[model samples]
Target: MQSLDLRRSGAGHAILVRGGRMARLVLSAALLAPLGACGIPYGTGSRVTLSEAPPSAQSTPSEGIMQALTCMRDSHTLNRIRFGIAVHSDGTGKSSYGYEGATGSFLPQGTAAIWASEAVIRAGGLSMNYYELNTERALRQFGGSSLDTALATQQQTRVPNFIISTAFTALDFIGGPSMDIRAGGIGPYYNVRGASLEVSAEMYRPGDRMTMAISSLNRQVFYRDAGIGGGRLFGKGKGELVTGTIGFTDQQRLQEATRDVIALAVADVLASMPVVPDDCRQMVENLKAAHKARVNEDRPQEKPAHGSRARRDDLPAQSPAPRIPAEQGPASGTIANPDKARRNQR
Candidate 1:
């Protein structure tokens, strides 16, 4: 009786152990099931999506200038007009973000001027002596004799017919009141910001030193956003949770707006010029061809020759089938033409 009781107790212990192991296995399986849906491939490799880099900021201005030049070329209104660009200034005389002090150390002096020069050159209707302008200070430092000698040596040192200048006349920034709303434990905050800029430009004939054409442009940019925050019961857990969100305001937008304004001003100023520079037209053609080549290069290559059904039809026709000679054969090499063999035997 004592041995039977001990045996029964051992059996019960084994049963309990088995039940515990089974429960643990089921729990592990439940936990691991979600991992299968994660889409992660087993092994050492990682997944990535490949793409090309974005184009440069200058691309916009360059493309805009190209289009304007194309229009001018088509209409046959382009002519070779010599011109020079001087440093643009903030004529407003008010302190702004970039222009802070009297010395004007913060402002970008040639931003618009350089764009205009490039536009004129790319249009193929204007001429600018970049080499002369670049070397002017150095030549002057060598004295009047050295300057005269340098000018005499140069084959082309023609004076500019007109000088172009630009000025930033106004800048304004406005901000809307920040508003926060809450409903049922959820809250959202909203606000708006705006910036306005004004620019003026003038074209002056060198001979008379008088303004031939004047133009002004005003541009404004705005940014707005609403940020949301809320809390809810997730999986019966009570814990602090934070989620990150992307903002819409990009600082580069301001620079882009400035470039756009410069491009427009350049187009307007060039329109009033008597003749477009000849070199600018050639540059336009070159830029167009380069853009075409770049676009073609980025396009996917043609499919393989065998993969294309259209090319299969374009292939040369195959030659006629070769003729096969007649043959006779047996285990002992019996001849098919037995009559000829019999004649030979006779």
Candidate 2:
């Protein structure tokens, strides 16, 4: 198949572009403003930064790459849904957070604090361990044993590509209210600033040629903070999300992106395997050829004969239907999962 484009301009731009005033104000105030304003006068919104182990802590580039690869190998959707559950089947810990609110009134202090916040509210505040559990489950569903091993072994060289791809897939799901929960707040309260996320993954094969796509998701926001006494003021805040952009923008895009990468990665992996069936090998080649053909068609030179809803619908479907199996899955809401009992016990 065609080569993967690893040089992806992260969703930072998109997020910032979408950020509107809140984001621009943050950057301007944070970077350009005088020193006096930097410390206190300038309102700073929340920031979420993925804190990897210290550079000295890692042994090699491979280690660093593996860590980055978790953006996909792990499952974000499962974690958000499962952890969102506040009560156990037995009944306890019925508390929930991360929903819509206004003026930050009547919201709890700790978990409830996130409600009045925007994306990536606090850098290094969120724990990786808390997120790791759900991602582990997500990895298992994708037939991966462990993100660590998946990133290592030369046999699975394309781990980074897949990880990045999966990250975007999960983001789409999380950010898209249709899949995850999307909350809104009262104006003059919490305004989103800028946001960015980059995810990378790979699939191991004997040689070159793996399928991966980089996606950047970004948004810019604007708002005035309002409250009583300490809370009420002409408070303005700015925030930005600047994770890597090597995956889809949202979840719907993720499903399509993952399947495409899997198809390409599987073909390459099977092509290199010593113990493989001829039928599978042929299938791989066939898929690769098809993908290459489609990519060529997408070149800038080729313009659609007609660009309209009717014309677009007339085009052949590019992907197959998704196969979502039914099981006792976690609910995507607070106070919904049985695991909340476990939290209560803690």
Residues 1-346, candidate 2, lDDT per residue (tens digit)?
A: 1222222334565566678778778887787666654446333674444468856652221222223223222323212211110110111122334445433322122331122111111110121222224555666567665755663463343222111112221121122112222223212222222212122222222125443222222211122222211222233564443222122222122112332342233223323332323343344445445444554445554333112112212224633444344322322322476577466457
Highest lDDT: which candidate? 1
Candidate 1 per-residue C-alpha lDDT over 209-247 given as tens digits, one digit per residue, 9 for 90 to 100: 987766566666667776775654444467555444333
TM-score of model number 2: 0.19
Residue 253 in candidate 1 has what lDDT?
58
Count residue pairs with overlapping backbones in model 2.
Answer: 54
lDDT of each: 0.59, 0.30
lDDT against true structure, model 2: 0.30
